[model samples]
Target: MKKILLVGAVLAASFGPTSVLAEEDALLVEARKVATSLPPKLIAALQDEIQKSGAEAAIPVCKDMAPKMAGEISQQTGWKVKRVSLKARNDARAIPDAWEKAALEDFDKRAAAGEPPAKLEKGEKIGNEYRFVKALPVQPLCLGCHGPIDQLSPGIKAALSQNYPNDRATGYSEGQIRGVISVRKSL
Candidate 1:
């Protein structure tokens, strides 16, 4: 009887946190699936636009499609999904709220500590909502517009100037953190 009780206690103790972790992991997985679908499609469209109409044309696709894509995904998934940055080009969407600011800083630290940017994510339950943030590293392709200001082509530079005059989103290197996909779902 003593051994049976001990074994039962051990099993319960072992499964407690694992059960919670597993549930949270499932939430992260679902959020990831929702986020992962949107960006590549937008990136593909941006790339094709750049290939045909030049890099200048791709900017509008990003500016316009990003929000539309977010809205569509939010509607379909019942999650409030958006992109944000520490240094924002679009002030409206890129501004991080209190929780998001903390998550972004944490992600930056984790990424600097040798974690893969693609694998870095933060998810938590706060009050009546669940929040998650996934890192979006600066890809080699992103450097065309997002890299150093001096490296930008004349046309691209002029377009950025006209479109986002107060842009603070330049001067990034490849593999660096650019922004995040933030999802908030109400419980």
Candidate 2:
């Protein structure tokens, strides 16, 4: 009886996921791949720029090239892709709508509760679109530009002031959630 019960429990656990859950998980996987593909390239480009011309030179790459790359990704994926944060440097692009705001808040809580930001994500169907967001944690490379305001180098500060006079995307530590890659697909 004990052996039979154990086997039954194993079988049930193996097959327990509902079809809807399975589909959602698959959707999340697709969403994550599209979302994650850009950052690494952007980081590598920024690294090259910094190494060749210094950290200040990388500012334009992030401010201009990053958006262009994101736009290309959006064109390829046929889904709206963007970056947003609680403290957005670019007011036009970083502002989160109501749903995105809620998701970011939830992500913060989960990360606070020991969830790895790299593995953090949220997705849901809203009206006619399926929305997804993946947390972007502050990395070591990010600190040079997005670190504590007072701690920034003079050149970096001047560059930021000239480029983004009203920037608010600072005061972040490594491993902290800096922003999110937000994606949406019409259903």
Candidate 3:
């Protein structure tokens, strides 16, 4: 009976991880669908207003709106949400997570060579253990903040400086890895 119990325990343990991965993957897919659809439309609406009024007036609104959207997604789905990008051309840099950083670098290389925008990589260790990472390329609208320094408006740059003082999240072109959705299951 003890041996039978031990075998059952082992089998449950093996199945547990698989179940967790499936759940995590499902939650991640949902969260991505929500996040990706929201940001660009918000940014475009804000950009139209900015064109009429100017960046100074629009920056605060956009800045506030960004995290509010992230917060909304978090509230709706109990998963953490975030944004990350490649190091700026000028700053001494550290990515939000290293595994993500490496994946972005590879994604950027592939994109630069005229490839597709999204990628999935496996077994990339972040923090404590390996995880599956999905990198999505930032679109043209993202260039206003994440693009080259010369292209940024003074107000937007000021906003970026104030919001993310250690930011290395600029100088990204369209089709480059702006960041990723990194999800792992809680054991």
Candidate 4:
């Protein structure tokens, strides 16, 4: 009876941590799904806009339409979604909160240490909320506006100046992390 009780206690103790880990794993999966669902759509929209008009014309797709798409995703998924960066383009919208700032800083360090920027992501539970952030690596297409200021086309520069006078999101090369798609949900 003593041996049987000890075995049972050990099993219970092991299962307790396993179950919590499983729960965290589940949250991470869901958060990843929610976090990844936006960028492709935004990219497609930007491509279409650029093709129809020009890179200068496509500025609104990122500046305006991306947030609207994120809003729609938030409504559909019950998770709040937004973009943030260490060097924000839209001063009003792209500033990272404390947690997001920490995650972005960590991502940059990891990327600098030779981790692929595309694979840099972090997800965990904080208080009653599950939060996730996925790095948005700068693509060749993003360089029209997000590349070095000296290299930007005159039209693109004018548009950015007119729209976001205080923009700081520039000087990024391909594969560099531009920002993160941050998502959170109350658990």
Model 4 clashing-pair count = 0
Q: What TM-score fits each model?
A: 0.87, 0.86, 0.60, 0.92
Expressed as tens digits, the lDDT of each residue in 25-88 for candidate 3 is: 6655654565465556666767787688876677655456755676676677554555555663
**Model number with the top TM-score:** 4
lDDT to native, each model:
0.87, 0.88, 0.63, 0.93
Please give, for residues 1-187, the per-residue lDDT of candidate 1 as tens digits.
9999999999999799888778778887888888787879988998899899989879988899889999999999998999998888988779888888887888889888888888777888777778888888988889888999999999989998898888999999987788899998887
Q: Using alpha carbons, what is the TM-score of model 4?
A: 0.92
Write candidate 2's Cα lDDT for 85-184 as tens digits: 9988998888999988998898889888988988888888677778899888999999999999898999999888887788998899988899899998
lDDT of 2 at 118: 86
Instruction: Give residue 36's error in model 1 in angstroms.
Output: 1.4
Clashes of each: 0, 0, 0, 0
Query: Between candidates 2 and 4, which one is better according to lDDT?
Result: 4
Candidate 4 per-residue lDDT, tens place, 15-64, comes to 89888889999999999999899999999998899889999889889988
What's the C-alpha lDDT at position 138 in model 4? 94
Best-fitting candidate, scored by lDDT: 4
**Candidate 2 TM-score over all chains jointly:** 0.86
Lowest lDDT 10-mer window, candidate 2? 14-23
Rank all candidate structures by their lDDT, best first, as comma-separated numbers.
4, 2, 1, 3
